[model samples]
Target: MPLTKGRLLLAALIACALSSCQTADKPPQPRFTSTSKDAGSATTTKVATSRYFIEFRSRYALSYGHTYVVFGKLDKNGNMISPEVAGLAPASHDPSQYVVGHFIPVPASTGWTDGDLEEQYRSASWRVLLSEAEYRDVVAFIRKQQAVSKTWEATVNNCNAWTGEIARHMGYKTPGIWLRPQQFITQLRQMNTTG
Candidate 1:
């Protein structure tokens, strides 16, 4: 039986419409296939340690102008996990200044006119006055500073890296203050060597 032209046109249009509707109803397929083998890329990891040197002093009324220095280990999380620190005292006849309660380094030659025995006695007198109470506060503050310092370094902006740590950790959040690592190292070295 030969189909009429009108009937054939109607059948073709219905087939086309059904095919388009079926295609439209289907869900999207994923681009990649499942694989049992893992890719063999090895992960590289790095560990960090925080090292610190400390000096603390006060010249307020009724208090002697005394200074002390302590060096200790710090953990990966920037905590001072060690309870004990190596104590140090200044060289006798060395004249130096303390910046905001931290001692600054002086020239080695300035320590004494003569490496005289008497000068040694004087330097030895500048011993660390460590007590359990003061030690707790000092260590706690240092640990706080260490954690914040690393976080600030990750910022990587020249000004932010320098100033951000001090401002945030020290609670001096006013903008534009720069604190370089070298400056910190110098202060710590001075304190460690001085007292």
Candidate 2:
């Protein structure tokens, strides 16, 4: 039997759900590329009072969207210096990995993923300042999480859950994992910011 319009729409939705973190646009160059000037200044005296921060972020993607964390030190002038990103997604750009991820665990990547830098894709963000001690602890936790993160399953081990673990480590309350990335990030900000 020939497929109907409704069937076609349902199939499209299913495909989108399976290919969760894929983006249609070609990945853009990162905004914070190191320069020769920066490389030459590596031996400068360390600032006595630097601010560190972790920004929980959500961005648009092919599926429900993505959530991640950007963290690093900031100068007294509030300029970022060598920020790092971490998130969880299927290891391969191949759609099959995302498809299988919905059923069985698929290999996952815990470092920077697509849409981390495109400002236009950002939906929500919550940035929290950290003391040097807190920053060290959080960075260590993120690195350890990256080292151990092995697989991705849409419902069980998706991006939201990964970020939630980081937020919990920082002593912030996280919304439930089932929420869309944008909603989860927005609620996270509201829940943690209010006294």
Candidate 3:
């Protein structure tokens, strides 16, 4: 082979090596590769252990004493659910199917609407921090509740009841304070000393 050809090949190899080194210095982005199986495609998500908060809310000002609770993962900046939404529509605007004057345990994530929460939430928060194992345990508890029975009562068996059950299962205390959503969840928070 000619000397010039050999030199060109060596230069190309050096450039490639330097470029690869540069790329390795940057952090890799999370990638989702989808695969088609049968008639549908599925994308597997990276299941990193996440922390969740049991957001406790209070009764709305004009809601005639109503409250609720929900679970949410802490965001990248450590933000959990907030019950505050300024100037939201009234509870009577588009009454929540699961929250308004009723007592039923709905899935925390998709149970109520934003307006429903803002209209009813007075001012309180009960956040239960969860490890990965605790998160799974809490999830199973929720699933069992979902599979069983669901009944709603006017002021008796309501969303606070749902959160109370969750609090007990999560190894917290529920000292029979079932009516006031605000106070009940505050007790749960006080009991969540470990997680």
Best by lDDT: 2
lDDT values of the candidates? 0.27, 0.74, 0.44
Best by TM-score: 2
Give the TM-scores of the predictions, in the order they appear.
0.20, 0.74, 0.50
Candidate 2 local lDDT, 151-191, one digit each (tens): 99887789999999998987767898867787778777666
Cα-lDDT of candidate 3: 0.44
Clashes of 1: 5
> Ten-residue segment with the worst summed lDDT in candidate 3?
30-39
Q: Clash totals for all models, in order?
A: 5, 0, 1
Model 3 Cα lDDT, one tens digit per residue, 1-195: 699998997677556433422321112112221111111221234222344644455443433333455555666555544422111112233457434334333323314534345433444554444565665676676667655534454334455665567666655567443344445544454444322
Alpha carbon deviation, residue 47, candidate 3 (Å): 21
Please list the Cα RMSD from the true structure of every candidate, rounded to 1 decimal place: 31.8, 9.9, 25.8
Q: Write the per-residue lDDT of candidate 1 for residues 66-148, one digit (tens) a residue.
A: 22223344456433344332112122332332111122232211111222222221221111222344445555654554343
Whichever of 1 and 2 has more TM-score, that candidate is 2
Point out where model 2 deviates above 4 Å. 1-50
